[model samples]
Target chain A: MIPCAVTGIGQTRYAAKREDVSMPELVREAALRALDDAGLDFDGIDAVVMGKAPDMFEGVANPELFLAGALGAAGKPMFRVHTAGSVGGSTAIVAAHLVQSGVHKRVLTVAWEKQSESNAMWALSQKFPFQPPVAAGAGGYFAPIIRAYMRRSGAPEHIGWQVAVKDRRNALRNPLAHLHLPDIDLDMVKASPLLWDPIRYLETCPSSDGACAMVLSADVTGDRPPAWVHATAMRSEPMLFPGRDEVSPRAGAACAQELFEQAGKTPADVDCAEIYVPFSWYEPMWLENLGLAESGWRAVDAGRTALDGDLPINMSGGVLSSNPIGASGMIRFAEAARQVRGTADAHQVDRARLAMGHAYGGGSQFFATWLVGTEPPG
Target chain B: MRPVHIAGIGQIPNVRGDTDHDEVQLVQAVASAALAEAGLHKDDIGFFCSGSSDYVMGRPFSFTMAIDGVGLWPPKRESHVEMDGAWALYEAWVRLQHGDVDTALVYAYGKGHGAPVDGMLTAQLDPYYEAPLGPSPMALAALQARALIDAGRLTERDLAEVVAHARRLGATHPGVPAIDGPLDVDALLDAPYVATPLRAHDEAVRTDGATAIVLSVGGGGPRIGGIAHCIEPIELGLRDLTAATSVRRAAAWAGLEQAGSIDVAELHATYSPQAVLLRQVLGLADAVVDPSGGALVADTPFVTGLSRIAEAARAVQGGAVRALAHASGGPCLQHNLICLLEAR
Candidate 1:
């Protein structure tokens, strides 16, 4: 396999609604930024890869076809990937594969979601004929899983509140984050309304309209420093079975395990991580799943996941701070790249050399992850 | 990079409406058949990928449910594409190049008969300009057909001939619904136009179906010579509708010129005129085209593309030396993919 590196990264300012621009314009904003950051134009790109959660989110099926011109992908190999919420991370990984496989030298990948166009909750809760109806939205479905985790781990309720406050505060430093709560605190999070049992309104991710893009190349070609991709992995399993473990799903663990093994590294070598934390409790659940912490809630209670902690997680506020659904995973991946490249601005982890990005989707059945470092792999 | 081959292919008979089976069952039947043909168990498969659309199912994350058919007890490496399954095959091909996985399972399923497929396809158009106008896929294809006629590049007789030939061949394939009437060119030309310059015979037959293909590295099957795809601009006004420039570019990239003479060409031409247009663009004058009747007879959404490649591989398995398979997406062939296969 050929070596691949991320040379450019761009993100849109996430918000509940981006009414000023159309979907094409919304994606073009991030794509143009990525191209400019790479010190190249559309002519330099060899192919384009796009991803989104589902076409129903925006009432547009196969949006990549209409977006071909907007992405400057005319007369180029354009591809679209969809794997539920993990689509963004998978999109980036597919783009990297185009480079790693020696098929294309320069690849531009983008993932975006315009949630304002349609109600994602309603779209997700649709009932089909001869199938069980979805009685609850995403939060309602995951709340019981959180309850299971709390019972299994015997963790205190305060762990969820603490995560909410920490991530929101971290969002204050990220200018592009959707929610910048300077006054966020444990008390405020505890006082927030309870949308689902064991899950609070503030603990949930906000639905935002945003996009994220990256320019990957076989060789580091941009003027900026490159974050060499050490390894990438994706895994999937059935959504439900008789003995499936909803908490700490095997697919996610296997994905992360393969990722680290390929990179020849361990959790200790990872200085920071950007994980998919749609809800506050998932930060701890995923920490254990990724093998970042032997006792995930214990790590959070000990302040080990704090911004200044030994292994700072979600330094750029993560999916909790700004959730665009589809782009959230790529945001995690891009933030990890930013940390290792020393270009994370105010959210930069001090002397960060190695970082990890992780995402999961579809009842925690689909998983995608990548490990990146400052130095190229041998 | 490691060499990849089409080890096996599986497809269910196309039907207008399959009320008896759900997406999972449809996928399971074909996936099992393909794996059985490859002589491999689920444990031997290293990766899994599928192509599907949410609109066809009228639900989000529809592909998630299809994984149950593949069985994820050990949690396999998996991904999906929103486009045709042909693109999914391309992705699996690229994944094989990493040399970590030796075999991959690719499948696609669609229930187009459950909904107004032509009207649903309008959602693929530009939302700001075209979708609001509500031009059905047939309408778009008719416009392209009209442009070809105005350019003096094709006539209605030429289209009728393509449809006539496809119908005669389609009658022999069990997967296609048997045609009941005369298949003469004049008879096809006399049919009422569903859209201007395009009769019902000119459009693809919308059906519900599923398809699966197994790809392996260094396996005993038809070796993949070259595989590449390209896309054209979205705006219809900007392109010369008489020609398929993207198809020419993709063919060049796939080393079509260096592949020497082609023995068979299976094209995913959703419309009869496209088959004529592609034949002219790709310059396949001597190759046998659509030996399995192609998409015109059984144009199952998302499955037609992969079925074309499967048919091409089957042709090679039957002693053909070299073959070409083409899959297309978007209105009027805005996106095109070509896979070149040869006997090992």
Candidate 2:
């Protein structure tokens, strides 16, 4: 396989509502920034790939067709991917494959969501014929799974509150994060309103409008250092079946195992990671699923996931600090790329040589992951 | 890069409405048939990809539920695209080039008959300018047809001839309804217009269906010669509606000139004018076009594009040496993909 590298990364300022720009303009902002970062223009790109959660959220089907011109994709190969919340990571993986497959040299990938236009909750909770109604939103659906993890691990409730406080506090270092709570504490998080049983309102992700973009190339380009892609993998299973493990899903573990095997690295070699944690409790659950932690709750208790720990995670504040649904996964991937490139600024992990980005969606069925390093893969 | 081949193809008969089966069953039937034809079990396949739309199912994450039909006990490497299944095939082809995966399964389905498909298509248009005006797909096709007529490239009688030819061939394909006796061009010309310059027969007969194709490396099937796709500007005013420049570009990139003497060409032209336009653009005068009736007979939304490739493969299986297949997306052919296949 051909080697691929990430030379440029761009992100829009995450907010509850980006009413100032239209959908096309919103995506163009990130694309242009990424192009500028790469020290290239639209003419340098050979293809464009885009991903988003659903069309119902923005009232437009196949929005890529409409935004082709805005992204400077005219007279070029254009592709669109949609795999639910994990779509952002899948989009990045697809773009990298285009380079890795020798199909194209330079590929521009983007993922965005404008939740302000329509209610995502209503769209997700719609009743369909001959099917049970999904009256509860995503949080309501995942609350039981979190409870199951608590019972199985015999962990205390403070772990969720601790993660909520940690991510929000980290958001203070990220200027683009939507929620910059300077005084976030465990007591404050625990006292917040309880939307779902065992899931507090402060532990939930916000509905924000944002976009993320990256420029991938087959070889190193531009004056800046590149984060070489070591390996990428995606795995999926049935959403609901008898005896399926909803917590610590097998698909997630398999995906991570394949990714590490391809890269010829182990969990101990990873300097930091950016895993999708829309709700605070997911941080611990994914740690165990990815095999990064033998006991997830114990790791949180010992602050191993903190900024100064042996394995720092979500240094750029994660989905909890800024959630755009579609762009959230790519944000995690881009942040990991930034860490390996030593461009993460205040949130940078010390001597970060290797990093991992992970995302999962669709009732914990779909999974996408990638590993990047400061040095090229052998 | 490794050589990719279409090992097997399977599709259900297209119908106006399929009330008996849901999306999961539709996927399971075609997937099982394709895998059986390839003599491979689900465990042998290394990668899986699907293409579908949320609007068709009236729910988000619709593709998530569809994976249940594939039966994921040990799980598999998979992905999904919001575009047509032809693009899914393209991604799978790229994956095969990575040299890690050997076989991939690609499938797509759409329930177009359950909703007002034409009205729903307007949502794909520009929300700020075109969608609010609410021009259905036929109206947009009429604008292109008028452009061709005004350019002196075609006449109303010529479109009637295209429709007559499609209906006659469509009768032989199981996916479409059989025509009664012979089709009359004069009768087609006399029919009232659904939109100006476009009679009811000029448009496609929308149906609900599913299609699956198994692609493998170093397999006993038609080998993929070259495949490429390109996109033009989205705005209708920004492009020359009378000409399909993107198709010309894609065909050139797919090595149309190198694939000497094409025997069959299956095109995803949902409207009569598009068929006429593509033939001229791709220079397929000597090739047999749409032997399986084409999309004008029975268009199944997302499934139609992949079905075009499947039909072209069937032509190769029937002793054709070389064949060309085309798949399109967006109104007025905003995006186009071309695939060339040959017998090994």
Model 2 RMSD in angstroms: 1.1
* Candidate 1 C-alpha error for residue A339, in Å: 0.3
**Model 2: CAPRI class:** high
Question: Relative to the unseen true structure, what is the C-alpha lDDT of residue B100 in candidate 2, on a scale of 0 to 100?
Answer: 92
lDDT tens per residue, model 1, A265-348: 998899999999999999999999999999899999999999999878898887888999999999999999999999999999
Docking quality tier of candidate 1? high
Candidate 2: TM-score of chain A is 0.99
- Per-residue CA lDDT of model 1 for B1-344, tens digit only, reads 68899987888898888988798999999999999999988889998989988888777888999888989779899999998999999999999999889999999999887867886789888898889999888888898999988988789999998888888898999888667566899988788999989998898888899999999999799999999999998778978888898999999999999999999999999998799899988888899999988899888898899999999999999999999999999999999999999999
Q: Model 2 over residues B48-130: C-alpha lDDT tens digits?
A: 99998888777888899988777766989999999889999999999999999999999998887776677668999999999
Q: Model 2 segments beyond 4 Å from truth?
A: B179-182
Q: In every candidate, what fraction of the native interface contacts is reproduced?
A: 0.90, 0.80
- What is every candidate's alpha-carbon RMSD to the true fold? 0.9, 1.1
The true-versus-predicted C-alpha distance at residue B160 of model 2, in Å, is 1.3
